[model samples]
Target: MDKVYDHRKYEQKIYSLWEKNGAFTPKVDKSKNPFTIIMPPPNANDPLHVGHAREVATQDILIRYHRMKGNSTLWLPGSDHAGIETQYVFEKKLREKGKSRSDYDRDTLYNMIWDYVKDNTGVMEKQLRQLGASCDWSRFKFTLDEKIIKIVYKTFKKLYYDGLIYRGERIVNYCPLCGTSFSQLEVNYIEKEDELYYLDYETLTIATTRPETIFADVAIAVNPKDNKYKKLVGKAAKIPLINREVPIITDRLVDLNFGTGALKVTPGHDPVDFEIGEKHIPSIISVIDMEGKMINTPEKYISMKASVAREEVVKDLEEKGYIKKRERLHHSVGVCYKHKTPIEPIVSKQWFIKVKPLAEISKAALKKGEVKIVAKKYDKIAHHWLNNLKDWNISRQIVWGIRIPAWRCDKCLEWTITDGVVPKNCVSCGHEKLIQDPDTFDTWFSSGQWPYATLLAQSRISNFQFPISKNDKAKFEDFDYFYPTSVMNPAYDILPFWVIRMIMLGLYATTRVPFKIVLLHGLVRDRFGVKISKSKGNVINPIEMINKYGADSLRMASIWGSLVENDSSLSEDNIRGQRNFANKIWNAARFIFLESVAKRGGYSKAPTTKNSYDLKIIKQLRVTTKKVTRLLEKYRLNEAAETLYDFFWNQFANDYLEKTKSRRKDAQKILDFVLQESLKLLHPFMPFVTEAIWQESKNRFNNTTLISSSWPK
Candidate 1:
């Protein structure tokens, strides 16, 4: 064995060997129970950061451990076709080339993005290998793959025909910059300090944060219980800048304590106002276009950006005595998750899934413990979100995803949603002239079916062809065996964005939970506990970390440094400490090989007389093995890692190895057994170093490889 364990020298070589030998492919042994995990597919739009590294490491630990335990294990890998994010990245590249998506037609732009993502997917898969993700490469999937897209289309068609999906004009979180609509879960809310404008309407003062949306206001709202506005409930008020007559109505939704005790109702621009307008008001006005530019307003304000229009409107209102007062206030505002631009609530015709019924089933399942959430605290959060669920907006104005199957008749304007292919005529009116819906399904809409779709794709029953018969039960041997996956490990920040949707859709499609266990991990932050982001210039590249400190060392540091449920901050010093731990293991193994075995040529038999120290060490090893197994079973990975580190470094290397130096033969026998067993226990956490040492000492073991070796008993 070499004096030092260098991970860079062995990681790629060992990973390639494992891949070549099909070590990651699951063996369908009917005797042993099956264990499966569907990887939370990463976005193929960019290189992975440290968070992805940690996630892959944790998942690989579980996978390798289960495989060694003689279970038919599978870790399926894939990547997401992140609609808005991919478009954003490609658009940036286009700007560098002095062009944009508009430079080509829809089909051309879609194909361009597909090619861009294909290249990026290769880069991401290579990175996953570098991080030692032992996912079955043969079963790798892409969200936009023909087979997966077919499954997505089938799910959409099923939901539409079942009356769970509808198309209507409703307020949606619209990212003007991306020219798309997002579900509420996709918007990130940030608090900002801005001026609250108090505008003078005909007889009442209305307060609003977005003065630019005044033209869309259909009414002025006051609390029915507030005495200050009791007499003005049934009156009409003229809008400030637009001079539009809007009714003054009493609504319990109004917060009387909030500025001026009156609210401007802009149904086309605010979610709460839309609900109120839908109930009481007849007309809905939309003053802003999909591009975030002013529209359906005066020519002076037309075509101006919302922020620019805000300034112009505010200035004009003050000069015309329509601005009664202005106060500084801090309020939370929704923004696009990708571009960070303020999200505009726009009323548009979009497809929506009625989520209330689905949420009820998921909530009941949680209470029944059909799906167990780790760290129990998140159960309340999941429950609350489901209890107050709103209809999910699952349509986006993008071209690089599964186009909605619905089509409209060009002559009669009636719509028809077919199973897969475009119909010859509309279902409502037999008009041959038809146009397909120009929008695609939201990214999450397709990803929500990831667990089922990926498994269905693996089945022989699915031929990657759309319009699958509704009566045909989508089932195969693999789907039946791994339908309810054993575990689902995902970042906690995406609890609502991805997790809940997966559970709901999984149950809806398969009549079973997506996974039995939901292990939620936290964000990967910097040393200061601040989240790592490219904009902050604090993002840690996992590849750079691997290059500097070996992949095994980096994995050890990530596991030992923090618990699964808590945010962990990475530092060079922490990783360096783990590297030193790796060195200790290497040196100890080298000492056992050089001083004991090599000096005396190999031993033919086990030590006949067991000394007191030998018995003591064996007892400690048994206890440690049992403890580590229990910890791993309970998903207490950090505790398991720390326990192994202490037992190996402090107990075995420090105390036992020192005592056995004088007794070479006995030392060889005992150290060989202890080291081999220790390697098995630690292999899951630090696979490369352990595997390299195991390979060097392969003659002492019966197993062909450490990864396929039996778990420590």
Candidate 2:
């Protein structure tokens, strides 16, 4: 052993050896239980950030540990062609070159985005390898892969035929800059200052921040509990500049205390108003178009931008005595999460999934304890979201994703939903001149089916890029064995956005829970506890840390910072501390080499010895092994890692090695036994350094690799 552990030299070499020997791939033993984790496929748009590193470290620990436990373990990997995000990123790149997506047609734009994402996906995969991820690259998948799209299409057609999918003109969160509509979950609400204008309706006074939407107001609503507006509820209120006499209505959802207790029911702009309008109002008007410009109004306000038209409308209201008073208000406004622009609520005919039924199935499974949640704190939260589940918008006006497999006939204008390809003719009208819908499915809609789809895709595809240990085992039934994966590990922040959807869709499509365990991790933050983001300039490039301190040190540091249901902080200082731990481990290996004790006995069990130092280390290793193994089994990884660190640094190196320094060979059997077992316990947490130490002792131990070694009993 070298005096110092050179991580850079040994890390790649060991990883390549593991790959060459097919240690990463699982064996097809029907006797052994299968343990699988379908990796939360990261976006294919940009290089991974620190958050990605944290995710990889957490999953890898679980994967490698399970593999050693003699389970048929699999960590399947994939990439996401993140629908709206990728298109938005591509457009930004186009702008850098003084071009726009509009400069290219749909096919040309899609092709360009595909090439860009392909290049980035390759770069991201290399980064995953650098982090020592042991996922099966042979079965790697992409969201846009023809195999994946087929599964997505299958689900879509199934839901459509089952009456769970429908097309309706409903209010959706539309981003003008992105030229796409986002689901309600995709909007980010921000608190900002705006002017609230109290308008003089003939019958009642109404206050609103958006005077530009007066043209679209079909009714004025007053809370039924508010006695002040009881008489005006049945009367009509005249609009300000539009001079339209819309009926005043009573609604339970109208707030009695919010600004004069009279609400403008512009169903075209508000989700609550849209729900109320569906019950009372017969006509819906959209004054603002999808381009963020005023339309369907008088000529003067028609072409003006919505923001510019707001000023014009306010001026007109004041000139005509329609404005009663103006006051400054600080309120929450929903905006597009990606572009940070106010999300325009517009009525668009889009595809939707009736998710409440699916949510019910998932909720029942949760209540039955079919799926276990880590930390147990998110149980009530998961139920809360499941209870409030609503219809999901599944359409995105983009060209970069799996386009909706539906066609509209030029004759009957009815849709013909098919399975991922254009039909010969419209099923509704038999029209040969049918046009396919130009929209694509929302990214989450496809990703919701990730666990089942990926496994099914793998089972169906015969060829593999890097076939793992073909001679060891032929390909067996993967989907039947791994359809319901062992664990679904994702960040807690996306628990509602992504995880909940996965459960709902999984149950609806497969009639089974996607995974038995929901092991929720948290965000990777900076030392000051802020989220590591490129926009905040706090992103610690994971590759830089791996280059500085080895990937082993980086992985250990990541596990150190993370706690259950809490954001983790990774600092350079922490990584350096872990590097010191690696050095401590290396120094112990060097000390053993210098002693020249050639008898490296692979003790299956601890030896009973009269020497107190030998007996004490053996007992400590047993207790530490049992405790650490239990913690990891329960998904308490941080506690398990802490236990490992304490046993190795404090008990083994500090006490036993120091106490037995005078007569090393006298305790060689016990010393080698404890050291080898400890290496097995720590290999899952820090693979490279521990495996390097084990490989050094391979000659004496009959050439057994630590990775393929069994867990300490």
Candidate 3:
């Protein structure tokens, strides 16, 4: 704790000193181009998980690298107002006090949440800072911040007035427990063993896992070419519960070999059914309600929840001559992330954005290479999403998000929409009382506009960010410099959601792609390829890792674990090895400093610009630096980190420093260059420790600080 490579003492001292001295601030100029990355802010509800830490560390490395390269860099830090997650956390807290979110009024509850979020945000910020993130903390912006909210409103109004936004009845992934509809991406599908209930539809017997949905079944479908069910085509089968006659249809959409060679079309319940409804059976009645239970399916199964109805319907089917047999089958069902409840796609009147036009623009941009995907592998993924893009449903029936600004007029019954301040009276009706729409914008609605909104705080734009001219009116100097960002480093899971949306928004607003490169990272799983989870008792606590091995060590382990493009696993042993690497750097720096400190405290000789020793290290440094930089440019973060680790730990610290220690008389020059170069290289990944030793070394050749030192060009 006193000295001697005490990680806690040095890390704390170094961070406090650097922050106080504004070490993370990158010099900005209208003339010099800037490097920028908008961080994928996590909701401040939970503690910083390992996955979150990896992203932060990766972003930090990019930002710091750019900063050292003399490019003005800004890592915009912020948090999303995660409606469901934050609401759940608050609800849990309130429940502990014997209350519910519904118990409080919306405004009062919102105020309470605002306080809660601010407090939670502080905690996360501290954790990120402790991890040595070089983000410009002074420029941090939250999604709920007044400025961001205004941007959201402005975006909504622009999109609405342009006819790209509308309200209509559509099927959405619905979770009954949460009483809300989820976006497609929010739904998780899990394969489970379910019962395949055989039901005799007159002469044709069909199998179904969800016997409850049999009441909602519009038509029993068989493959057109299936000779077995050829005679059953055009025949009507009476449903078990309501006894409503449904025609047995011949359609190629049905798989002849799947589930007794027959399929049921429940347009109101499933996506596939909805598609079939659009094409073949539009007149079919929907018997299932929003809660996934039988609504108008008759008295026996009506009003029961879907889960309860599953059992009841099957029992009745067995007793009433409808059941033929039941067999076990493996099937995939969507589940909500929070509640783990099965997600049912139910028809609902929600707002949607006409995304085809936007998607076309995005597709064109990528086709033109205006928006370059980092990994190149993402090109296929991007193409898949854009080519098969569907209209985006931007509305959510949640209380804790940006409220939809459309309002229905009492007199005219027509909706008048505005993103500006709510009108006291409806524009059409002149009614004194106007009701604000209760629906909240989907989380992605706000997220989609991040690239533009964060830059210009506007939705629509008429100009690009390049070729700076006096006549141009783009707001931020940084935006102009960094617009059409070099890369967008993010996870591949969001290719359809956030990544593609950003590209589309960029094309719509700026007539260009948001970023030229996109670095994709894989998920961090456990050693055995199983995902880390608290319930499974296999989750690694990042906080505990930090306390034991220090933040730098944990980050290094993350780098090491990121061996490939897809899912990678981390082990405690690997983290400890990273800690050892940090200790090695510290010990080497201490050794050099001790010799210099003992020699009556005078300046040591600087490394000759042309010496073989200097050239060798410099050449190696250049090769290492260039290789790592290129890798990062390509969004190969793990590869880049690996390169740095090998060079710094293996070559510089291990080989060069050991030799330099023996030649103590001329060691001053070699030591200075090695320390400076190593610090410059390691600054991105291990900021605190490097800067701590850089300051303590006392062999100052230049007046420039470690944080602002130029990267080896």
Candidate 4:
């Protein structure tokens, strides 16, 4: 029984052999078309979690299935230098040693980070390797690598030169801990219980969930179409805390049935207020600072944090003549995605990408059938975000990221941007004194260029051989060959932020859709449908699972728990079932190997008149291969894995294995065929175990390793 399938010893040995043999490299025959996928790069500071494992398994299955179908497949592998997250990690590490990031200069700290990554990156890579990722690791790219950063800067300059990127002061999300501005997608909406303060509006009353924003209110808005508040328009109302009189304006954006018909417009704090402020020029009052504190407000509230100011404002409103009544309310509040803290929309000068131009191209691409979404139901959601998309905020006030290439000369105060960097002398005044933009490009700005930036390294190394370069024509060999990649597989959460922006930038740069198909996987949530978060202590560590059971076992478990189109839970019971299934395959392989060796190559001829057992097994093999093939083509990897698992364990190992044990010759043929086909189907999911067993018995079967071998015909 190979001593109960020694997974630990065999998993590494087998994987190393596969790597040595170049099994992951595609067979580059011009006759066969290439199938490619750029993996969603994960932050390297942490190990792979259950959520990440599921995504990797899905992609691996697709790549392996396509390879078996004789298509040249390339599953490009890489990691991201997650700017904020990684910076936080290193800072924490420094803090533990009683030092801060400021102790070292940018270059010194950056070198330390690179050194840390060099030391720890192999840990996660080895974990992924154990899961049997058939990624061409030799072609791996890092987002912060010199080549990738150059490509990122080049893309940024192109957009700036084309006037698509601009800087302006606007209300944006501010994270107190990170001390940086976040994009709209970087904020997650959560329901919170709060009080709706109904304040006196002349004779009537206006209820508000955020009474603190009243300090910054520029105008009170009522729906233009609502006759109930039509008479209240063009009137003046005194703010409760600050006795400032703001004119009441009517607009259609207000929902008459929601809370009170009168809505306070805090032009410098709220998005809707910004829009209203633009329509009707009103007195601007910015009560909040970048640190989310009241900068300039009523006397008692000056220099207070936003939350503290809320309490003071509420109490003052209740004591003053403006407070009519209050009611408990539950509503969605936007919070920073990383720290889960409420985001403050404080106005600040930042770079933004005008989304309308890119959005039109994205919509046209989908409408013209250039981009396709799997499952089809997501099309409406995609369209809704695309149609109503606002301009993307693309700048961050942080130290550790790609610095803005544009510079401002102090002498002439003229903004200048060269292809790579601004010249030492100012173009206007011939002054050598120039200051680089203090802000960094947003993280998404770099990630948006991932699909093309990956090729930048190859482009540079190959001396601009790739078709994505400035001088290279789109009709060039490489672009025509791999320009429109086969598919983009990512989580559904990135639909608005990353996916849509990539579609727009890819079209602008390559003049084509980045990939032809988008495979959106649902989140790996808990059993109750709540996301497994680190704060909630519900996060499952993949490294712990790998230590207990081998990575192949953990990977198979993830595949089993995953549903093709819906969020699924990673339960312990599910993983145990997967372990048992792996054992079943191992035991069956051992039994077949012993029998065939004993009979000195047992079955040479294919059996014609088969028993019910043989027919049932053959029929299952045929049906399973066909189903898995179709499912893989459709990117239903979880379904494909499920189909293979059930057939291999239930029908073959349980019923068929016991039934055909006695009939040596006929049984061996049936077992060989079923086992071979099952391995082919399961190879992508559990490459280590499958290849280990296949290589051990290669003399009696096929010559190639399971990794590179063609699928069952």
* Local distance difference test scores for all models: 0.86, 0.86, 0.74, 0.77
Which residue pairs does candidate 3 place in steric collision? 374-518
Give each prediction's root-mean-square deviation over alpha carbons: 2.6, 3.5, 3.8, 3.3
- Could you arrange the candidates by lDDT from highest to lowest? 2, 1, 4, 3
Model 2, backbone clash pairs (residues 3+ apart or across chains), number: 0
What lDDT tens digits, residue by residue, belong to model 3 across residues 1-713? Answer: 11456677777677777678887665567666688887777786557888876777778888888887878787777788887778777878898999987798878888898788877787788888778877777767677766566667766776777788888787788877676788777888888898888888775777878778876788877888888878878888877756778878877777778877888887888787777776777854556676566787768777888889888878878878788887889888889878887887788888887888988888888888787766567789888878887778887766777877778877777787765577777777788666677878888778776765676642244333322244564445555666777667677788887998888766666666788777766777877878888887878877788888888888877766454357778778878888888888788777766654343322233346655665677678778878987886665677887888888787777777766655676656566666667677788887767777777766453333577777765
Model 2, residue 324: what's the lDDT? 86
Model 4, range 256-361, lDDT digits (tens) per residue? 8877777888878888888888888555678888767777776787788889988888777667767777788889999977678888887888888888988999
| Regions of model 3 farther than 4 Å from truth | 1-3, 222-235, 248-252, 260-262, 280-286, 291-293, 424-433, 457-472, 476-478, 561-564, 595-606, 609-626, 648-662
TM-score of 4: 0.90
lDDT for each residue of candidate 1 in 1-713, tens digit (9 for 90 to 100): 87778888888999988888789999656688889999999998678888888898889999999999999999999999988888888998999999987789999999899988887788899999998899998888889988888788778877887899999999999988788999988889999999998889978887888899999888999988999888888889999877778889988998888998898988999999999898899589998989999998889999999899999999999999998888999999899988888999999999999998789889988989999998878888888789887999999998888899888988889778865677998788798988899899888888888987887887666443322334444345566677689988899988898889999988887778889999998888888988888878887778888898888877877776677878888877778889899889999988877743542322323344559888888889889999999999998898999999999999999999999978877567778888888988999999888888877774665466789888878
Candidate 2: what lDDT?
0.86
For each of the candidates, give the backbone clash count.
0, 0, 1, 0
Candidate 2 local lDDT, 1-713, one digit each (tens): 77789999898899899999888888667899999999999997678877788789889999999898889999999999999888888899999999998899999999999999887788889899999999998889999999888888888988898899999999999999999998878889999999999999888899999999999999999889999888787899999887889998999999888899999999898899999899999578999998999998888998899999999988888999998898999999999998898999999999999988988889999989888787768878899888887799999999999999898999999889877767888888788888888999999999999998888787655333211234412453676677689988888888888999999888887678889999888888889988877688887888999999999888888878457456788899999999999999888876766655555547677766898778778889889999998899887788899999999999999988887788787876777777778888998889999888988864544246788888999
Error of 4 at 82 (Å): 1.8
Q: Judged by lDDT relative to the true structure, which candidate is superior, 1 or 2?
A: 2
Which residue ranges in model 1 land beyond 4 Å of their true spot? 463-475, 595-609
Q: Model 4: runs farther than 4 Å from truth? A: 1-3, 27-29, 91-119, 200-205, 226-235, 240-243, 258-260, 315-320, 425-431, 461-480, 526-530, 535-538, 596-620, 666-670
TM for every model, in the order presented, reads: 0.95, 0.97, 0.90, 0.90
> Candidate 1, which ten residues in sequence have the lowest lDDT sum?
598-607
Evaluate model 3: give its TM-score.
0.90
